[model samples]
Target chain A: MIGTAQKIAIEKTKTSKITSVDFDNLPFGSVFSDHMLVCDYRNGAWEAPKIMPYQPISLDPSAKIFHYGQSVFEGMKAYRDKDHNIWLFRPEDNYKRLNVSSKRMAMPELPKEYFMEGLKTLLQLDRDWIPQSEGSSLYVRPFIFASGRGFHASPADEYKFIIATAPSGAYFSSGKVKVLIEETYSRAANGGVGFAKAGGNYAGQFYPTQLAVEKGYQQVIWTDDNAHEYIEEAGAMNIFVRIKDTLVTGPVSDRILDGITRKSILEIAREEGIPAEVRKLKVNEVVEAAKNGTLKEMFGAGTAAVVSPIAAFGYRGSDYDLPQLEKSYASRFKKRITDIQYNRSEDSFGWRFKV
Target chain B: MIGTAQKIAIEKTKTSKITSVDFDNLPFGSVFSDHMLVCDYRNGAWEAPKIMPYQPISLDPSAKIFHYGQSVFEGMKAYRDKDHNIWLFRPEDNYKRLNVSSKRMAMPELPKEYFMEGLKTLLQLDRDWIPQSEGSSLYVRPFIFASGRGFHASPADEYKFIIATAPSGAYFSSGKVKVLIEETYSRAANGGVGFAKAGGNYAGQFYPTQLAVEKGYQQVIWTDDNAHEYIEEAGAMNIFVRIKDTLVTGPVSDRILDGITRKSILEIAREEGIPAEVRKLKVNEVVEAAKNGTLKEMFGAGTAAVVSPIAAFGYRGSDYDLPQLEKSYASRFKKRITDIQYNRSEDSFGWRFKV
Candidate 1:
């Protein structure tokens, strides 16, 4: 076991691309920082962590990752405060969840020292890359992939863990997104890897989401694979439904992601005396609520977008437009979360980690 | 659209590794041939196909394949006849299914000529890598992955398609395997990418299969995710159950792979006047048949293993041993398939393609 006090080897790049980037007009994940952290798991043990220049990786053509998709990832962000102090929202949670995903994929669990020390060193080295603009942060992506060379359909003996960060603007540049209630395609099954942030889960959604995009919806709200009756997730985020004044979101199970942002919102709702319910949100119930004019709001929660409000939703060839409010729960939760992330407010939940 | 007459660029290796390999003892999917096929899809079109020396591939760390698992693959084999002529069984079917998987993963479809011409050129260059021993052949793997650099959760704009071949022995070295009927973990779900040869689908099964291995079972007989009642697949292959005299197998659906070898067996059974039924085979039905001594055999069918017989199966803490017969359907189908594959018998189905 590696200790948290272990030093991470860092090799700085000769020149940085910070000057070339337009932080004001940044895209969601197109631009990356100068340095990245890479750790390899070989011979049944993880090697020393190293922070080096962000570059392309060379792998064998028959690597298991290319054929079997033995990979998992975590999405997080680093926010810059008014005084230029960097803070991460629930970094430990991300680390723990990453291992949870790794175990489910039959990959080796990464040591905390390697993940934490390496991430901090990489972020400190590339501190200038963190955008300080409003609603802007450095989007950090930590991923692990099978690096073993073989064409066999089995678990890999070698693996690679890498952390790449991108300085980006808002996830949804538009004010609010219009989503379609998916009835044909499903995101996850009852006993599948849907709960894990596995790579294949995202790949399986591209086609169905593209169809929804063609139908004028920005994203698709995925339902259960068994019967498509219960609502599950929205795009890649955990979804929430606001019926009247109570906040209703589905419980995390083998088929739903235990999202950090989603959990934070539930806690914040409790702290603010807002009624919140964590239960299975059925599609027909939401549709009935929408038809009766009781569905107040709906939004998605994840690391990329802390809170993305859904303006309207289409289901069964009919569109249901959500009512716009002056001071909605989405806006309220977004401000509370971002305030804590940016270090502009009190950290009552101890969710902010200073770097 | 590229035509069949298009010439493929070839770069042969000066030194071959054939001299170092011991053909008598070959492992599955570990030894690679001298050359491989490579093609790139960029700017909304596929580039010219090229055959190059087998080597490592360079990709960006943020490539969609690494994080989103946008990949699909096909498994095939090349056999050497008595006259040393290379033959491919149902190669066109594999090609069509590869595209079907691509479409489901939102990937660009490879032109038939690029696939066929490139594969033949590469195989011809490494003709010596095709093992002539009994139950041995050149296992060919053709796969495509997202090569575009991005961190967004969407379909990739660029992709790479490659074909790598390996000289290997039998997939199951042991004569018969003991399988565990899975009830907790599921391989695929309804309305999911279970039918497609998606990389993630294979990755998700590794952990559960590992558990079954610990329980003295070599592989798992996967059931439906909704309810672990109906049998779907055996390991990575299509499963067939013989109850009394009639051969029974599940019909292909969105949750079951349309295996080439599986379909071929059904056709062969029809030609041989063997009773075969294509329908859903429930676990209780099989268990009842096994208790009454009506279950004679169960086998797996796929490209890697033409037919792998199962000796016993465990479900709900009880083990059921299958009766061994002097003239079993498993042995008969195995001989019939290999005879056709090695050109020892007549090719009545026109399934053989000459290179």
Candidate 2:
């Protein structure tokens, strides 16, 4: 086993591109930092982690990633406090979830030390890229793919682990998004790889989400595959529905992602004396709640958005508008989570990790 | 629209690597031919196709294919007859199916001219690499992936269409394969991408298939996700079960792949006066058939193997061995298909395409 204290090889770029970037006009994930971390797994062992200049990678045409999609990834963010101290929101959870995804995809599990040390070193080198403005941070993407040269429909023998960070603005810039409740298209199935942040899971959602977009919705609320009656996820995030005074979200199963932001929100809600239920939420229940004027709020929670509010929803050829509230649960949860992430709140839960 | 007579730029290798390759001991998909075909889709149009030396491709770390799994592929083969004439079986079907998969994955479809002209030119350039042995031929892989740069969960703006060929031995070398009937895992879900040749569809099966391998089975017969009672597919191929006299196979739906070799087998069975039925096959019916000694044969059909006979199958902690037959449908169909493919028999269905 590789030790956590293993040294990481660093190669600094001769010149940085920090001066040419427009921090205020940055897109979600377009602007990458100067340095990245790369590690190769070959001959049944991961090589030493290397932090080098961010550039294109060369891979054979027959690489398993392109042919079989044996790839997994994790999304995270590094926040900059007023005192210039960098913080990460529950990064260990992301690490564990990445391995869970890797195991499900039949890829090799990455060591904790390689992920942590490499990410920290790369972040420290590109500290200037982290946006200090409100709702802006460095979106970190750590991914692993099958770099082996073969076309067989089997697990790959070689892999590549990479960490790339991008400075980004808010995922949903200004308004709450409108989502279509998808009944015809499904995101994941039971006993499948839906819980894992596998590449195929995201790719499979593009077509259905595009149909929703064409119908004037910004995203889709994916339901269960077997029945398409129970709510599962909202686009790439875990969905929470506020009915009456209780917050209800689907329980994490083999078909739903175990989102970190989602769990944190639940913990914060309970701490604040709010009722949060993790159970199977049916779409009909939400539709009835909307019809009876009991649906107060609905939102999506993930690392990218922290919390994205849903302004309206369309279900079964009928549009339902949500009533705006002065003190909505969506805003409260977003504030509570971002406060912990940016070091503005108490450290009672020990959720913040200083780098 | 690109016409069928579009020009394809050709760049030949300065030297050949054929002399170094040991053709007798060839692996499945490890070795590649000297030339390959590459075409790019950008700005809402596919560019002209190009035939170049088989080599590695460079892409940014944030390429959508690495993170989103927006990739699809098709498998084919090139056969060399005794007179050195090259032939392809049902090439148009492969091309049409590639686009069908591309549409389902939200990828840009390749022009017919690009796929046909590019493949033909590459095969002509690497004709010497096609092994002429009894079970040896050039395996062709036509794949497309999202090459655009982004990390968002949406369809990419650019894509790459590539064709790579490898000379190899038979997929199933000599003996029949043992399979496990999966009751806990699934290959696809209803209203999912199971019908398409999407990359994620294959990757999701690796872990479950690995479990079957650990239990002494070579592959798995994946059942439906909802009930795990209906037989869907066997490993990466479409499965067929023979009970007494009638050959029964599952029909293609949103949760099952439309295999090329599978449909051809059905057609050949009908033409040969063999009873064939395409419908939903129940696992319990097969178990009953096995118990009564009426289960005669089971086989997997796909482009890679053409036909692979199953020797035994295990279900719910019970192993069942099939009776050895003097003349099995697996052998008969494989011979008939190979005869049509190699131009040794009459092309009644006009399935052979000469390059």
Candidate 3:
């Protein structure tokens, strides 16, 4: 582990591609920033970090990451305020979660100082890539993978951790999206790695989500693997339900991710004197609420999208449409969080870290 | 897709390292052959295959395989007979399963010609790597992964298929091993990717398996995710149970892999006039059989170990020890499959494909 006293070596790119990027029509994660932070773990410790030009990484064909899926990742964003100041929202949470994910994947844990210093150094060098437009930010992706040259099923002796940033617009082009209730497929099960930000959890959802897309839905609401009766999460996001005057969501468990955005929303709701409950929300109960006109709003919360409203949801053989509220919980929280992230609002919880 | 008429380009290593390997202490998948096969899928089709020295592959930092776990792999072996000839048992079956895994992971399917030619070319160039000793062979690992540069949570447009070989002795050194019936964790569930040879399926089992290992068990007999009532597979191999005079195993489902060795064992059992049944094997039924002193033996079947007999099984709170037999089914089948694999016996089913 590299302490805060150690400096990260910098390697600037010879040419800049900022002008070549179409900022107005930026795709979610297709365009990258200039520099990236890289660190390797070997000989029982993490080496010094370095910031270099974003490029391809070479790995052995028998790397355990490509064979056993021993990989974990975290998604975050760097915001640019109107006054040209940059901010990171609860970055410590991401670093802590990253170690948790590494433990579950049987990989070495990354030190807090190494993770923080690496991100800070990389972000400062590529500060210009932070988009100034509202609802747009520089998406930060930090990932680790096994790099050892063997096909053994056990953990790899060597690993590489990388931090790459991409200029992005809103994760969802359309404000409101349709979701299909996944009845046949499961994203994870009890005693599984669903709680960790592991790569396999996301990869397992593509086929089922693709099926939902063919049915005109943008995402699938994943259920518990055993019964498929309780709602766990939506595609890459923790879901929330607004029933009359209360905010309800499934409680965090080993099988459900502990999303930073989800935590912030629940904290904000309670601080604002709103009624909120965290418990198991059965699929039947939600469908019944939708039918009885008690389900006021539904949305997904994650780093990529602060809050994406669900326009409608499909269950077994039927599509239930949700009414657009005059003032929804999703809309209220999205504005409050984005404002806090951009430094336009007061920071009461000390969630903002300036860079 | 490349056709059969297209020839694979070969590039051999200038120097060989066969003498450096110790045949007496060969690890399962540690030592590699001199050459490997590579094929790329881009622009909606597979390109011509190439055989080159086994080495590292360069990929972008944001490749989907690293972030989303869009990877699949297969495990088979090449046996060297006493006559100094190599044989691949059911190689076509492995190729077909690789495509099935690719489709499930949303990766591009490799052409049959590309898959077959790549393996053959690489095997011939490094034929000496196949050890001639009994229970020693060259383990073939064919895998495919997403190579496109992006962080989007979707299927990649680019993929690479690779076939690498490693010299190996028996996958399991112990003749009979202890197994723990997994009760808490689920290997896979209905509508999950358990049936596919995807990388995540293996990764998810590591932590749980490690816990079982600490309890003095070498492997685990995974139960279904829902009720934990029905048996699935054991470790990476399909499981078989012998009760009284009948051999029974679970039928393949969306939650179980269709193992080639498992299929061949069933066929051989019928041909040898042994009673066999392929259907749902409930956990309670096996426990009941053990209590009544009717359960004779249990074993795992796969390409690596061929047939590994189980000495005991622990379920709930009690461990049931199996009695040794003078002429066990496991011993008979192990010899039969190894004989068939090494071309020491008649090619009754035309299962051997000579290299």
- In the order shown, the candidates' DockQ scores are 0.89, 0.86, 0.70
- Say which prediction, candidate 2 or candidate 3, comes out ahead on DockQ: 2
lDDT of 2 by residue, B1-355 (tens): 5455346788888888889999989889899989888888899998888888898999999999999999999999999999999999999999999999998899988878788888888888899998888888899999999999987778899999999999988786567789999988777878889999999998999999999989999898989999998999975789998999999999999988889899999999999999999999999999999999899999999999789888999999999998888999999999999999988999899999999
- From the highest TM-score down, the ranking of the candidates is 1, 2, 3
Model 3, position B12: C-alpha lDDT score:
83
Worst 10 residues of 1 chain B by lDDT: B1-10
Fraction of the real A/B interface contacts present in each candidate? 0.85, 0.78, 0.65
Model 1, B37-80: lDDT tens digits are 99999999999988889999999999999999999999999999
What C-alpha RMSD separates each model from the true structure? 1.0, 1.1, 1.8
lDDT of predicted model 3: 0.88
Q: Clashes in model 2: which pairs?
A: none
Quote each prediction's TM-score: 0.99, 0.99, 0.96
Best-first order by lDDT: 1, 2, 3
Provide all candidates' interface root-mean-square deviations.
0.6, 0.7, 1.3
Chain A accuracy of model 3 expressed as TM-score: 0.98
Ranked by lDDT, the better of candidates 1 and 3 is: 1
